[model samples]
Target: MLLAPLALVAACGGGDKGTQEPPSTTAVLVDTLFTFPSQWSSPQLTLKAGGTVVFMFEGGIAHNAIFRLNPGNPPLAGAPADIPPTVNAVVRRTFATVGTFPVNCTIHPGMVSEVVVVP
Candidate 1:
Protein backbone atom coordinates (compact mmCIF):
# COMPACT_ATOMS: atom_id res chain seq x y z
CA MET A 1 0.00 0.00 0.00
CA LEU A 2 2.76 2.46 0.97
CA LEU A 3 4.84 1.40 -2.03
CA ALA A 4 1.91 2.10 -4.37
CA PRO A 5 1.47 5.58 -2.92
CA LEU A 6 5.23 6.23 -3.12
CA ALA A 7 5.19 5.16 -6.76
CA LEU A 8 2.30 7.49 -7.42
CA VAL A 9 4.14 10.32 -5.73
CA ALA A 10 7.26 9.63 -7.73
CA ALA A 11 5.25 9.76 -10.92
CA CYS A 12 3.69 13.06 -9.83
CA GLY A 13 6.98 15.00 -10.10
CA GLY A 14 7.81 14.80 -6.42
CA GLY A 15 11.54 15.13 -6.93
CA ASP A 16 14.02 17.89 -7.58
CA LYS A 17 13.41 19.64 -10.85
CA GLY A 18 15.91 19.43 -13.66
CA THR A 19 17.84 22.41 -14.83
CA GLN A 20 16.24 24.31 -17.66
CA GLU A 21 17.94 24.27 -21.02
CA PRO A 22 20.05 27.26 -21.92
CA PRO A 23 19.19 29.44 -24.84
CA SER A 24 20.50 28.42 -28.24
CA THR A 25 23.33 30.29 -29.90
CA THR A 26 22.82 32.30 -33.07
CA ALA A 27 24.94 33.26 -36.09
CA VAL A 28 24.80 36.39 -38.26
CA LEU A 29 26.62 36.79 -41.50
CA VAL A 30 28.08 40.20 -42.35
CA ASP A 31 28.84 39.39 -45.90
CA THR A 32 27.72 42.55 -47.60
CA LEU A 33 30.38 42.73 -50.27
CA PHE A 34 28.50 40.33 -52.46
CA THR A 35 24.96 41.32 -51.55
CA PHE A 36 25.36 45.10 -51.30
CA PRO A 37 28.16 47.43 -50.41
CA SER A 38 26.15 49.13 -47.70
CA GLN A 39 24.17 46.26 -46.22
CA TRP A 40 24.64 43.04 -44.33
CA SER A 41 23.02 39.80 -45.32
CA SER A 42 20.83 39.80 -42.25
CA PRO A 43 19.88 43.36 -41.37
CA GLN A 44 18.11 42.35 -38.19
CA LEU A 45 19.03 39.75 -35.58
CA THR A 46 17.04 38.63 -32.53
CA LEU A 47 18.53 36.72 -29.62
CA LYS A 48 17.87 35.87 -26.02
CA ALA A 49 19.92 36.90 -23.04
CA GLY A 50 23.29 35.12 -22.87
CA GLY A 51 22.90 34.14 -26.47
CA THR A 52 25.95 33.94 -28.72
CA VAL A 53 26.44 35.79 -32.00
CA VAL A 54 28.92 34.69 -34.66
CA PHE A 55 29.67 37.46 -37.13
CA MET A 56 31.18 36.25 -40.36
CA PHE A 57 32.52 39.04 -42.52
CA GLU A 58 33.14 38.23 -46.16
CA GLY A 59 34.32 41.22 -48.06
CA GLY A 60 37.18 42.76 -50.00
CA ILE A 61 36.91 46.36 -48.87
CA ALA A 62 38.23 48.06 -45.76
CA HIS A 63 35.30 48.31 -43.34
CA ASN A 64 34.96 48.57 -39.57
CA ALA A 65 32.02 48.06 -37.22
CA ILE A 66 30.42 49.86 -34.32
CA PHE A 67 27.34 49.72 -32.10
CA ARG A 68 25.10 52.78 -32.27
CA LEU A 69 24.40 53.66 -28.66
CA ASN A 70 20.93 54.73 -27.60
CA PRO A 71 20.67 57.15 -24.70
CA GLY A 72 17.80 55.36 -22.99
CA ASN A 73 19.09 51.76 -23.19
CA PRO A 74 22.00 49.84 -21.81
CA PRO A 75 25.09 49.58 -23.96
CA LEU A 76 26.24 46.43 -25.73
CA ALA A 77 29.91 45.61 -25.65
CA GLY A 78 32.32 43.01 -27.12
CA ALA A 79 32.03 43.87 -30.78
CA PRO A 80 35.11 43.60 -32.92
CA ALA A 81 37.15 46.72 -32.48
CA ASP A 82 38.58 46.39 -35.94
CA ILE A 83 37.10 44.36 -38.81
CA PRO A 84 39.08 45.23 -41.90
CA PRO A 85 37.19 44.22 -45.00
CA THR A 86 40.04 42.00 -46.12
CA VAL A 87 38.40 38.73 -47.15
CA ASN A 88 36.75 37.11 -44.11
CA ALA A 89 36.69 39.09 -40.88
CA VAL A 90 34.78 37.45 -38.04
CA VAL A 91 33.41 39.03 -34.87
CA ARG A 92 31.75 37.07 -32.06
CA ARG A 93 29.70 38.76 -29.37
CA THR A 94 27.37 37.73 -26.56
CA PHE A 95 24.61 40.12 -25.53
CA ALA A 96 24.25 40.24 -21.75
CA THR A 97 21.37 42.70 -21.51
CA VAL A 98 17.96 42.87 -23.14
CA GLY A 99 17.90 45.79 -25.59
CA THR A 100 18.31 46.84 -29.16
CA PHE A 101 21.87 47.13 -30.40
CA PRO A 102 22.06 48.95 -33.67
CA VAL A 103 25.11 48.28 -35.84
CA ASN A 104 26.84 50.46 -38.35
CA CYS A 105 29.95 50.50 -40.42
CA THR A 106 32.34 53.16 -39.31
CA ILE A 107 34.12 53.45 -42.61
CA HIS A 108 31.19 52.87 -44.91
CA PRO A 109 28.11 55.00 -45.20
CA GLY A 110 24.62 53.52 -44.73
CA MET A 111 25.91 50.13 -43.56
CA VAL A 112 23.34 49.53 -40.88
CA SER A 113 22.03 46.48 -39.04
CA GLU A 114 20.55 45.68 -35.65
CA VAL A 115 20.68 43.01 -32.97
CA VAL A 116 17.78 42.67 -30.57
CA VAL A 117 18.33 40.91 -27.26
CA VAL A 118 15.37 39.69 -25.25
CA PRO A 119 14.98 37.97 -21.92
Candidate 2:
Protein backbone atom coordinates (compact mmCIF):
# COMPACT_ATOMS: atom_id res chain seq x y z
CA MET A 1 0.00 0.00 0.00
CA LEU A 2 2.87 2.40 0.79
CA LEU A 3 4.47 1.59 -2.59
CA ALA A 4 1.23 2.42 -4.38
CA PRO A 5 1.08 5.89 -2.88
CA LEU A 6 4.75 6.55 -3.66
CA ALA A 7 4.25 5.37 -7.24
CA LEU A 8 1.27 7.69 -7.64
CA VAL A 9 3.31 10.64 -6.36
CA ALA A 10 6.20 9.80 -8.67
CA ALA A 11 3.90 9.53 -11.67
CA CYS A 12 2.34 12.93 -10.94
CA GLY A 13 5.71 14.61 -10.55
CA GLY A 14 7.23 12.95 -13.58
CA GLY A 15 4.47 14.12 -15.91
CA ASP A 16 5.33 17.75 -15.26
CA LYS A 17 9.11 17.52 -15.44
CA GLY A 18 9.44 18.41 -19.11
CA THR A 19 6.35 20.63 -19.36
CA GLN A 20 6.92 24.34 -19.89
CA GLU A 21 4.70 27.38 -19.70
CA PRO A 22 3.85 29.08 -22.96
CA PRO A 23 5.64 32.26 -23.91
CA SER A 24 3.77 35.56 -23.80
CA THR A 25 2.89 37.10 -27.13
CA THR A 26 1.87 40.59 -28.28
CA ALA A 27 1.64 41.71 -31.94
CA VAL A 28 0.81 45.15 -33.31
CA LEU A 29 0.86 45.55 -37.05
CA VAL A 30 1.31 48.70 -39.11
CA ASP A 31 -0.48 48.67 -42.43
CA THR A 32 -0.12 50.80 -45.56
CA LEU A 33 2.64 53.34 -46.19
CA PHE A 34 1.75 55.81 -43.49
CA THR A 35 -1.70 54.74 -42.33
CA PHE A 36 -2.38 52.11 -39.71
CA PRO A 37 -5.76 50.45 -39.79
CA SER A 38 -7.88 49.90 -36.72
CA GLN A 39 -7.53 46.12 -36.77
CA TRP A 40 -3.84 46.13 -35.95
CA SER A 41 -3.38 49.78 -35.08
CA SER A 42 -3.27 51.38 -31.64
CA PRO A 43 -3.57 55.03 -30.85
CA GLN A 44 -2.18 54.35 -27.40
CA LEU A 45 -0.41 51.25 -26.16
CA THR A 46 -0.76 50.12 -22.55
CA LEU A 47 2.04 47.92 -21.34
CA LYS A 48 2.45 46.25 -17.99
CA ALA A 49 5.54 47.07 -16.00
CA GLY A 50 8.43 45.32 -17.73
CA GLY A 51 6.13 44.17 -20.47
CA THR A 52 7.13 44.26 -24.12
CA VAL A 53 5.58 45.88 -27.18
CA VAL A 54 5.94 44.12 -30.53
CA PHE A 55 5.59 46.33 -33.55
CA MET A 56 5.04 44.37 -36.75
CA PHE A 57 5.09 45.96 -40.14
CA GLU A 58 2.43 44.68 -42.45
CA GLY A 59 2.03 46.00 -45.99
CA GLY A 60 3.84 49.31 -46.00
CA ILE A 61 6.05 51.48 -48.20
CA ALA A 62 9.23 51.43 -46.18
CA HIS A 63 8.24 53.56 -43.21
CA ASN A 64 9.98 54.10 -39.91
CA ALA A 65 8.77 54.23 -36.35
CA ILE A 66 10.63 56.15 -33.67
CA PHE A 67 10.00 56.89 -30.02
CA ARG A 68 10.59 60.32 -28.53
CA LEU A 69 9.85 62.37 -25.44
CA ASN A 70 6.72 64.46 -25.54
CA PRO A 71 7.68 68.01 -26.46
CA GLY A 72 4.51 69.32 -24.81
CA ASN A 73 5.89 68.54 -21.36
CA PRO A 74 7.09 71.82 -19.86
CA PRO A 75 9.76 70.39 -17.62
CA LEU A 76 12.29 69.68 -20.36
CA ALA A 77 13.68 72.07 -22.92
CA GLY A 78 14.83 71.79 -26.56
CA ALA A 79 13.60 69.25 -29.07
CA PRO A 80 13.36 65.68 -27.86
CA ALA A 81 15.94 63.23 -29.05
CA ASP A 82 14.59 60.61 -31.40
CA ILE A 83 15.02 56.98 -30.60
CA PRO A 84 16.58 54.98 -33.43
CA PRO A 85 13.96 54.36 -36.09
CA THR A 86 12.70 50.90 -36.99
CA VAL A 87 12.18 50.91 -40.72
CA ASN A 88 10.14 48.14 -42.26
CA ALA A 89 11.19 45.94 -39.43
CA VAL A 90 9.66 44.29 -36.42
CA VAL A 91 10.60 46.18 -33.29
CA ARG A 92 10.17 45.05 -29.73
CA ARG A 93 10.71 47.24 -26.70
CA THR A 94 10.24 46.58 -23.02
CA PHE A 95 8.80 49.44 -21.03
CA ALA A 96 9.92 49.70 -17.44
CA THR A 97 8.15 52.92 -16.46
CA VAL A 98 4.57 54.08 -16.22
CA GLY A 99 4.11 57.13 -18.42
CA THR A 100 2.90 58.42 -21.75
CA PHE A 101 5.29 58.60 -24.67
CA PRO A 102 4.95 59.90 -28.19
CA VAL A 103 6.07 57.90 -31.23
CA ASN A 104 6.30 58.78 -34.86
CA CYS A 105 7.80 57.79 -38.15
CA THR A 106 10.97 59.56 -39.23
CA ILE A 107 10.36 58.91 -42.90
CA HIS A 108 6.79 60.04 -42.78
CA PRO A 109 6.72 63.03 -40.47
CA GLY A 110 2.93 63.07 -40.12
CA MET A 111 2.59 59.45 -39.13
CA VAL A 112 2.31 59.43 -35.35
CA SER A 113 1.48 56.99 -32.62
CA GLU A 114 1.40 56.91 -28.83
CA VAL A 115 2.52 54.47 -26.22
CA VAL A 116 1.17 54.45 -22.67
CA VAL A 117 3.00 52.36 -20.17
CA VAL A 118 1.20 51.47 -16.95
CA PRO A 119 2.23 49.75 -13.78
Per-candidate TM-score against the hidden true structure: 0.55, 0.50
Best by lDDT: 1
> Model 2, 1-119: lDDT tens per residue?
79999998878654454564333333222222233532336566655555566667556545545566433444222213343534456666555566665666656656677666554
Worst 10 residues of 1 by lDDT: 27-36
- Pairs that collide in candidate 2 are none
- Model 1 regions lying over 4 Å from their true place: 1-36, 69-87
Candidate 1 global Cα RMSD: 8.8
lDDT of candidate 1 at residue 78, scale 0 to 100: 43
Candidate 2 worst ten-residue window by lDDT: 24-33
Tens digits of lDDT, candidate 1, 13-69: 644457644345543222222224667667888777666566666656555556654
Instruction: Give the lDDT of residue 119 in candidate 2.
Output: 47
TM-score of 1: 0.55
